[model samples]
Target: MVGQLRTHGELRTDTVTRAFATVPREAFAPGAPLEQVYNRDDVVITKRDENGLAVSSVSAPRIQAIMLEQADIRPGMRVLEIGSGGYNAALIAELVGPEGEVTTVDIDPFVVDRATQYLAEAGYPQVRVLLVDAEGGVPEHAPFDRIIVTAGAWDIPPAWTEQLAEDGVLVVPLRLRGLTRSIALVRERGHLVSCGYELCGFVPIQGAGANAERLVLLQSEDIALRVDGDQIVDADGLRNALTLPRVARQSGVEVGGFEPFDDLDLFLATALDAFGLLVAKPAAIEAGLVERSTRMGAKTALEGGSFAYRASQATSEDRTSFEFVVYGHGPDADRIANEYVELIREWDRLHRHGPGARIEVFPTATPHAEIPDGRLIEKRHTRVLISWPHLTSS
Candidate 1:
């Protein structure tokens, strides 16, 4: 597993690679299958709620390695980890070594108990395991040099910033627009700027920081729209529109099989006026209610009741290349789809080969004039700004 992580460029530093090599991932989950513990990219679900939804999990090894690399932890630096599972805490313990302190916190007692027992059993007894809501960070152990949040967070709580050391790094899997990106941010004056971000997903954080994404069901339990923040969704009107005739448009954009287009998703999420993720079950796709691409949340644009979602068309018999396509629904289908397609083309023309978006988080008290020109989104704790800067050709 460590070898695979190194090959994939996730285990960048020698210290991180050694941590991966040293930690016993199987010891944390006693009864889980060996294949599961050794899986390179799959997460092990540790706890679930009454509704059968995963509430806590040991994140995938790939994500753990990526976040650890982003963190750049060194010996003798105190680190705080939010949303605990025994394995990740053990990994941090390995990186921090005997000289440093590692504290992992969670809101649920059951999860905390499991993590505590497992960490002890895994030979990481020195790591502190606390059952506390991380909304108010562990103030008792302040001035952490590195803070890594494993759960998907809606916003950057003020306590996190308050407790972060002057030169600390806070790596969180933050939810922006409707997409989740594990952002590595550092303090900059009155704001925080991202050094880098990686595509990732995690079980949502619980307790005071819990802000679950709203799902608007359009086709019973099969199809729904996943929205975050204050994006107003008309469930009744959208449901009616979903049954209307489909309008499809093809953008003159082609992509190779292994090419990464997740950046385009971020561009649309920030550039579009109103955006949400259109998700559907496999049955819905097989029944022709939506395309196969939508099975894993598709980027969607909304105009009142009308909506449009992104899709793709295979351009090669070997299915090694594909063209971007858009599908629309409702009275404003044509306009929504045309607008969506234009943005697709614009991304392909400009940012497909350029640096990705610059994301920053600032306190709500920060004046709008001080913030950079971009899509400014207001949250309870902080305001997020996303800007795409143009590059100067040499």
Candidate 2:
């Protein structure tokens, strides 16, 4: 697993590589097969709810490695880890060495009990495993050099900012507009600014800080929109639109067949005034009701009684390239489809090669004048700013 991580460039430093090499992952998951334990890409789920949804898990090795790389944990630095699993705490203990403090907290009592037990058995008894909701942070160990959240967070709570040391960094998987990015944020003046971000996902946070995306169903449970904030979802209007003919438009933008367009997804999430992710079940796609993109949550723009979603068509006979297409439905289909297509072209022209959005979080009381120029998303605890930079040479 260590070799695979290093080969893929996920393990960028010797200390982290050594941590992965030394930690006995099987000690945390006793009955799991060795093959599953050692799989670098797989996550080991530890507990689940009554509905069978995973509530606690040991994250995939690759993900842990990459996030640790972003964290840049140094020896003798205090670290606070939220959403504890025994294995991750062990890996952190290795990075912090014997002198440094590693405190891991979780809301689930079962997770805490086992983590405490496993830490002792694994020779990491010094790692503190606490049964507490991390929404307020561990006050006894304030001013941590680094804070890493292992759950998906919808908003930045003021406590996280207050507990972090002035020069400290916080790495969290933050959900924005239904998209989750592992953002590494640092204190800049009175706000937290993202130094870098990478696409990643985690189980929704549980307890006082939990806020999840709302799914508005268009066709029973099969077709729906993953909505964030106050995006409108006219279910009856959209159900009627899906039955009517779909209005389609082609954008001149093209991407290599093997290229990743996650950046384009981020662009649309910010550039559009109203956006949600269109989700679909296999039955809907098999009936030719929606494009395949909906299976992976397609980028969608919504207006009253109307909506448009992004799709793609192969441009080459061998499928070596693809051109973006937008499909709309309902009363204002043409206008919504045109607006969606124009944004696609705009992203290609200005942001395909330039820096992506610069995201920042500030106190909710921050004056509008103080907030940077960009989309201002109002959250309960903070105001988020997403500003895109200008074009750069390819």
Candidate 3:
């Protein structure tokens, strides 16, 4: 697993590599096959909710390694893990060594009990396993050098920033405009600014910090729009718009096979005024109602009764390359389609290979004059800002 992580460039530092090598993952996930336990790309689900959704799991080793590298944990640094899975806590314990403190907290008592037993069995009895709401943070262990969140968060609570040390780093999978990225943020003056981020997904957080996305179903449970914030939409009109013809426009941007375009998704989420994720089931796609371009829903721009989403067409004989395309439907299909295509071209020209977007988080009460120019996503505790920098060749 360590070798695979190194080859993939996820395990960059020697400290994280050694932590992965030394920790016995099997001890945390007992009764699972050794092959499954060691698989770097698989997540072992440990607990589920009444709705059959995964509430807790031993996260994929690849994600674990990526977050740990982003964290840059040292041998004697105190770390707070917001989600409980015995495996990751043990790995953190190894990284922190004997002198440093490691506290793992979770709202689910079942998860906490399981993690405590597994950690003790795995010889990491010194690690503190607590059952508490992560929104409040572990105040008893305040002022941690590093706080790594394993669940998907919609906002940065005040307690987290208050509990972090002066020069601390908080690595969290934060959701913005319906897209989630594991952002590494550090405090500067009074606000937190992002240093780097990676695309990731995790179970939605529960408890006081839990914020659910609004799902507007267009066709029963198959086709829907996952919207964030108070962005109003004409649900009935959009549902009727789906029955109208779709207008397709080619953006003339070609991408090779297996190329990642998450940056483009993030760019569109910010550039557009109203955006949401268009989710559809296989039945809808098979019936020629939608395209199967992305497994995790399609990036969509909503304008009143009209909506446009991203799609692609194969440009090569062997289907090794694809061209970006936009599909729009509604009263103003042509205009929305062209608008979506223009943004696609702009991304290819300006930000396809640039430094990407810079994200920063400030207090909600911060004056508008003090904030930077960008898209502002208002959360309960913080105001998230995303700004794109222009790249110039030296």
Top TM-score prediction, candidate number? 3
TM-score between candidate 2 and the true structure: 0.96
Runs of candidate 1 with Cα error greater than 4 angstroms are none
Instruction: Evaluate model 3: give its lDDT.
Output: 0.92
Task: For each candidate, give its TM-score against the true structure.
Answer: 0.97, 0.96, 0.98
Error of 1 at 60 (Å): 0.3
Superposed Cα deviation of residue 255, candidate 3 (Å): 1.2
lDDT of 2 by residue, 1-394 (tens): 8888898888989999999999999999888888888888888888999999999988888989988989988889899999998888899889989879999999999999999999999999999899988889998889899999999998888889999999999999998889899999999988999998888879988999999789998989989989997766787887888887889999989998556788889889898888898899999999999999999999999887789999999999998899999999988999999999999999888988888889999999999998878988888899989999989665
RMSD of each: 1.2, 1.6, 1.1
State each model's CA lDDT, in order: 0.91, 0.90, 0.92
Q: 1 or 2: which has the higher lDDT?
A: 1
| Span of 10 residues, lowest total lDDT, candidate 3 | 288-297
Task: Point to the candidate with the largest lDDT.
Answer: 3
**What tens digits encode model 1's per-residue C-alpha lDDT throughout 125-188?**
9999999999999999998999999999999999999999999999999999878999999988
List, residue by residue over 1-394, the lDDT tens digit for candidate 3: 9999999899998889999999999988888888999999988889888899998999999999999999999888999999998889899999999999999999999999999999998899999999999999988889999999999999999999999999999999999989999999999879999999999989988899998899999999889999997779899989999999999999999999677889999999999999999998989888898889534789998999999999889898999999999999999999999999999999998888889899999999999999989999999999999999876666
Name every residue pair that clashes in candidate 3: none
